[model samples]
Target: MLVISSSCKLCCMSKSLTAWLSIGLLVALTNNAVSQTSHPNIVLIYADDLGYGDTSCYGATAVATPHIDRIASEGIRFTDGHAPAATCTPSRYAMLTGQYAWRQQGTGIAKGDASAIIQPGRVTLASMLHDAGYKTGVVGKWHLGLGPAEGADWNGKIAPGPLEIGFDYCFLIPATGDRVPCVYVENHHVVDLDPDDPIHVSFKTKVGNEPTGAENPDLLKMHPSHGHDRTIVNGISRIGYMTGGHRARWVDEEMADRITSKAVAYIEENKDDPFFLFFSLHDIHVPRVPHPRFVGTTAMGPRGDAIAQTDWCTGEILAALDRLNLTDNTIVLFTSDNGPVVDDGYQDEAAEKLGDHQPAGPLRGGKYSSFEGGTRVPFVLRWPAKVKANQTSDALVCQIDLLHSFATLTGQTLAAEAGPDSHNLMAALLGEDSQGRDHLVQQARTLSLRQGDWKYLEPGRGPAINKNTNTEVGVAPQAQLYNLRADLGEQKNLADQHPQRVDKMKATLGRVRSESSSR
Candidate 1:
């Protein structure tokens, strides 16, 4: 028998116990590493109407965006990134549903009282993540219409909205800043509704006796330049008419704080598990009312102040990530819904105060245009573990592709019909590959196709400039074509010079849009 003295046996046993403990520690670490690598927390921070040249990281000189720039410094910054559409409603719809917003008819810029555009039971990005055991939540501007299409019962539960579209939790502004029903919707009900003063909204006719901009301009703190001269809410004229729900009305300046608080709370609550947070921002949008702390942050007035506020909100989220010890395991994506537009509806001095600041950067057009500035937006991805730091990639990616790419990342098998327009570009997103979206469609009123270095714009019957916005509407009577590599600004049209290329591209686009899936 291999027996020894009692003291000797005890020493050997101790040595064996130490070896097993070391192995156990190693196994635990390895498992943690594997888990983090596989299931990274995703936070898609979508900014509303923020331009390509809005952030310092994207080449803006007027404002500094350290937190946004930090994301670019830590990970990949995509040069050729695009929102699905030029407008917020369509672009956001496309991003969440993984389908072209143009595919549906009701996806134009939505009103405050419009019905839910996205139907239930559809496989959406949030639904996909939810199925993969991720706690999905969305915060901020949700312009994709809520409740029923025509008559949304404001007093009742607002369904067929974000929750119906796959989001587990949602706190949203039902529409834009200029729209009516100026209330925050948390999940299904209004934040603080009163039974006595029942809310009623109407887009066509004046529902209540609320003072309107057109009727009474003297009461407004900020004046409307165009279609926003409708009903008055919070001293600002909105697009629709609202009778009641005074308590539920939101303060324009406190919007950033209110929305960001909900978003941060969501993160704090779900720190222990994997979560997908679509933090849609409302700053840099219309009625450019920044919080008191951010007032006069820049010489460019409310527009500049809003940009600073947006950066701060972004910083707050990043700080929350750090506080929760979820930095390395988190995949934070920063992008805009579309390009920027000055003087959208309100007289906000966004254009008058502008000295040398270029909101669209080197791009030609702004929002609601077929130009690069309309859809091409700032895209930054930060994943400390997977993506290398301080890298710039010229991959042609779109927000529409996020659906399939995330599905592939989480090992969730998507159905053949799901994410029909989305491509699995996880490699490109992580900075492993440069080629992304060989052919992408740019949408405004008319659709433009970008294939390789060539772009073809289909002719449409509209004015050269949107007189209201003072932006090039990108509408023309003649077919337009350009070599993007040759003309990045899209100044010289080569449609007459190269009809063959346009024809080929037009055919290619038809195939892309008509086919079942682009994968």
Candidate 2:
């Protein structure tokens, strides 16, 4: 209107274009920020051989698990939580892979030299989180095997392990505390080693010059109760034989502190970014050696003392979250790999000095059984930002359901064929609804089915009680059934009384097993 020049008009037009471009960039960035909000940091704390009645939150009076109990009090606790299997390796296999461990031929209680049970490139819980823009790590007992079927080279690089599966970092016990090479494997190699003294291992034969527990009873501080009399390390015998790598052997009593320190460090490093940490605790398991600091925290001897130590580890993890200022955005899940066992393979006074300490509580049997105590374990979850504080749910959730459930929480969709056995129970997990697993298959030597408060056990051929463990195997010649609502201890055989319910459950279990996948 004021008779502007062409050059001035072109300048104004360019400035207007720049303003619009800035607005577009801002909108795109805002969308990206919004998308990232759903992916919260997740920490899955798995305890080894912990039972439903082991924690004070679950009504154990022998020892109080304040740290573990806090998760139940602050977020949500499930009364009927279970592992996929009664033993460690199979249960861990099912938990990570979201497939029944029995589906695979080799998924048993793995030896120290056993190869990788979980094949790589398959979607695991860690891999799923990795794909969802989270850094993943696993610390502590990794008994699900490592390397190839031919076995791992203790001195050489260990492959096909946690790293190959999904984790960005792994500080593992390799097989277990009672297994051999008796060394810590961080990522792909032993944590500390002297090349001059290379390690050798074999589960099938005695491969070392080291004195066996069978031969060196005088040298042992804790004698083997049964099968664990192969290799001697730190005055204790393990299940597998190993020679050399003497410098790399771990001290049983110091394991809790050493493992917890590494886990805390991981949280510190990943505080700024979303991460998924699988902190597996080797606590209250066999060779029940509690840290000296927590030596006699309970009246029930080493097993109870170990429980106290386990609680300490839980407290350490929580403290890390708070120190890093990640508590509000972090979700912590606490559960065990399997049920309880008093005397698995060691003479740790776990069975002898059991003075009113109920590790299995109201459950029928302990570890290595088809009963409720075998698979049922303590489970608690906490996330202050998303989950309301101090809530409890009696949802019948299983560890196998975590893979799909977490995917949902992060707004991710698993492939239709993947996570076949996993159910999306996020609403149940968060206490948003009471709906949980309609049914879950419990595995021991045989399989059983649980649907709501009813359960059916198949007739099997096994010892009524395992002599070494002295645990009732829940085995019988007849089909056993129970209404858990009426018989929480699983005493009464209601199968003869309720035939139709047994038929329906038995049929459902058959289909679940016969199918290629549960999905």
Candidate 3:
């Protein structure tokens, strides 16, 4: 009887021990899974004036974009991707803030010397990501204005630029390549700004003896077809005025390499931990200065060469990822600030040399227009281990979705005021299903909405602002509706036939904008 009792006790002890061991093993496995699937290193590569069809994956017949194509080949390519605005500054605002650019006034295309557009204490993607234990940095074009709350004193000190807006470090052009104060701004101060040769800038009035593009077409190498006539630097006239900063002036051809190197260095330095790098490339934009190596390499002249340079820059970034062995773990996203515009300012023969090349793909307008091409752009996401290879999706995602999507991926939730207009697009971006936001507010200054195959343009009085390129900007007296699935060109305005559809869309837009406003 004693032996039997002892045997029973031993059996019970062994069962208990086995159960505890199983629990410990399960916990270990759960922790490992969480660590493996948790927050990914995010690298957002944004292009300036890059069109939807410019990339081969987006259906570029004339120009091949193999490096850009690699991104799509490896991950998912979103067909219904869009920028938040039709122009650079507004789109950038939406990208960083996750709120519609038009939500805030004075968030249009900023000149080189415009007062700081981003509010000082406002939440931004960079700031949010940084707060979540990710190192943040931006390299290349920062068209978002710099300086103080009131105005900037170029001679005194530059403050409250990228650093104020959540970036741990910034290497940026003060504005666009075709705008003035034509110099690089590293962190706060303008690079090589001579104390004696104080940089003077004015968008309203011309300053000093600098020859203007309007006055001297003879001296101009790249002629202006439209509104890009101002202070000429390196034989190209920019939009604003600048008297000095000759020593700090940047050569346009070398821009791609300069920014690429900075981006790669940032990655190499921060590869041990999670990082977010906003690699904004100034390519194929105005002042189309392709390096001598890439000059005359394409049938599209400097514009084509610029495209090649942009692709080359992509290749270099990919190489950096490969070298660091972060290719599998990193989540890289590629998109543009806005759509395409050939004759934006400089006469680069982007229009004349065009031989059966469709920059805007099958979309209607380009830059600063209320048409599909103006804001809709190529969006590609690549994550090797997590996302499947060679997938395409028709996800209705926007740049504004980045904040919430990242938050969702990292097991974080955003408050209502923060990521106000953002929606999580993890499944859509990963090519799980094309289903995404039921309705999206497309912008060209006013509001438009896209729901499935149908797109509605709000009735307005202004002419589509893209006069130089002659792309339609969706300005009409009556509400406009188009079935994008059937009419990708957006030629057939079905407002008369689709009155109920238009009404329903207007209601959806009203709800979204109103709800956003309430927040």
Candidate achieving the largest lDDT: 1
Over 222-288, each residue of candidate 3 has an lDDT whose tens digit, in order, gives 8888888888888888887889778888888788888899999999999988899999998878888
Residues 1-519 of candidate 2: C-alpha lDDT, one tens digit per residue? 689899999999999999999999999988855654578789999998999999999999889899999988989988888899999999999999889998889999988888898889999999999988899999999998889888888788999899998899999998888888689999999988889999988877888589989998999999988888878898999897899998898999999999999999999998888999999998977778888889877888888899999999999999999888888778999999888999889888888878788888899887899999999999999988779988888888999988999998887899977888999888898888785988899999889999989999989997889898989888998899999998999999999989999899999999999997886
Report the backbone clash tally of model 3: 0
Give stretches of model 1 more than 4 Å off. 1-21
Taking the tens digit of each residue's C-alpha lDDT, what string does model 1 give over 330-351? 9999999999999898988888
For candidate 1, what is the TM-score? 0.97
Residue 316, candidate 2: Cα error in Å is: 0.5
Give per-model TM-scores: 0.97, 0.94, 0.92
Alpha-carbon RMSD to native, per candidate: 1.7, 3.7, 3.6
Number of the candidate with higher lDDT, 1 or 3: 1
Error of 3 at 411 (Å): 2.3
Clash total of candidate 1: 2
| Top TM-score hit | 1
- Tell me which residue pairs clash in candidate 2: none
